[model samples]
Target: MAQARQLEQEQGQGSFVQSVKSELFSPEKRQGNLNIALSLSVFAGAIVFLRNFGELLAV
Candidate 1:
């Protein structure tokens, strides 16, 4: 009971971390945070595209 109360305080109200804990770190919650994901998508896309073009330049 006390542990549940402590979690709400440390992780913040309705935060990603708290939700992640609640969900037992499932893949769905792992992908829930958008800001962390955008950069990865951009990077992966850029890499794939650059490899096709044989250039490291940004599209």
Candidate 2:
């Protein structure tokens, strides 16, 4: 009985992982991921620029 329960749990986990993988890599999700990446890049760049500007002001 314990072995059967363990096997069932394993199969359930496998299906859950597959579902998550499918959702993550779907075309619609890819576009959203790209937008997120671009936004993060722009935000990081702005922060770096502001820090440099502040240092220059301090000097």
Candidate 3:
């Protein structure tokens, strides 16, 4: 009935999510994560320097 249909749909969705999660978090994803971290660090460093440039100039 409706309950059985709902259970089947839930099982199907769960398997799809697991497959996607496995793919997304594979070894290749580690490299992507590293790249993102490096990019963010560089961006933050640039912003910090720009915001404190006056203090740096006074030194």
Candidate 4:
């Protein structure tokens, strides 16, 4: 059972890496991925800014 679990984990990791490589090489997906990363960073930055602003007001 342990051996089977290890094999399964290795296979899962390999597939994950393969999928990432495919996405990275595909031009169509590149833009979508960049947009997603940009949006997530902006959202996080906004949250941090808001938290600091609130703290400043409290002081």
Candidate 5:
């Protein structure tokens, strides 16, 4: 009984890992993530530039 329970647990874990891999490594998901990252980086850069604009004007 214990061995059966352990085997079931392993199967569950395997499926969980496989789902995670699919979600993370799928091409469409990867491209979406990349786009989100690029957009966030550009927004951060714009924020930094606006915050430092006064310093630039002073120089």
Candidate 6:
């Protein structure tokens, strides 16, 4: 009986992990992640441009 309970718990844990992995790598999540990365890159580029502009003005 104890072995059966342990096996059930192990199977449940495995399925739970698989479900989480699927959710993490789903298409919608990937798109959202890509959008976030693109936005961050754009933001960084803008900051760099502004800094360069400020240096030019200082000189």
Top TM-score hit = 4
How many clashes show up in model 3?
0
If scored against the real structure, what TM-score would every candidate get? 0.39, 0.54, 0.47, 0.62, 0.58, 0.49
Q: For residues 1-59, write the lDDT of model 2, one tens digit per residue.
A: 99999999999999999999887788879988789899999999989998878667675
- Candidate closer to the true structure by TM-score (higher is better), 2 or 5: 5
> What's the lDDT for residue 30 in model 6?
89
How many pairs of residues collide in model 6? 0
How far is each candidate from the true structure, as Cα RMSD in Å?
A: 8.1, 3.1, 4.1, 4.0, 4.1, 5.2
Q: What is the lDDT of residue 55 in candidate 3?
A: 73
Q: What is the clash tally of candidate 4?
A: 0
Q: Which runs in model 3 stand beyond 4 Å of their true positions?
A: 1-25, 54-59
Alpha-carbon runs more than 4 Å astray in model 6: 33-59
Question: What ranking of all candidate models by TM-score puts the best one first?
Answer: 4, 5, 2, 6, 3, 1
Question: Over the stretch 1-59, how does candidate 5's per-residue lDDT look in tens digits?
Answer: 99999999999999999999998788879998788889999999999988989577685
How many backbone clashes does every candidate have? 0, 0, 0, 0, 0, 0
The better candidate by TM-score, 3 or 5, is: 5
Error of 6 at 29 (Å): 3.4
Model 6, 1-59: lDDT tens digits are: 99999999999999999989887788868888788889999999999998878677675
- Answer with 2 or 4, whichever has the higher lDDT: 4
lDDT of 3 by residue, 1-59 (tens): 99999999999999999988876688868788778889999999998888878476675
Off by over 4 Å in 5: 38-59
Model 4 agreement with the true structure over 1-59: per-residue lDDT tens digits? 99999999999999999998998868889898899999999999999998879677675
Rate residue 15 of model 3 by lDDT: 100
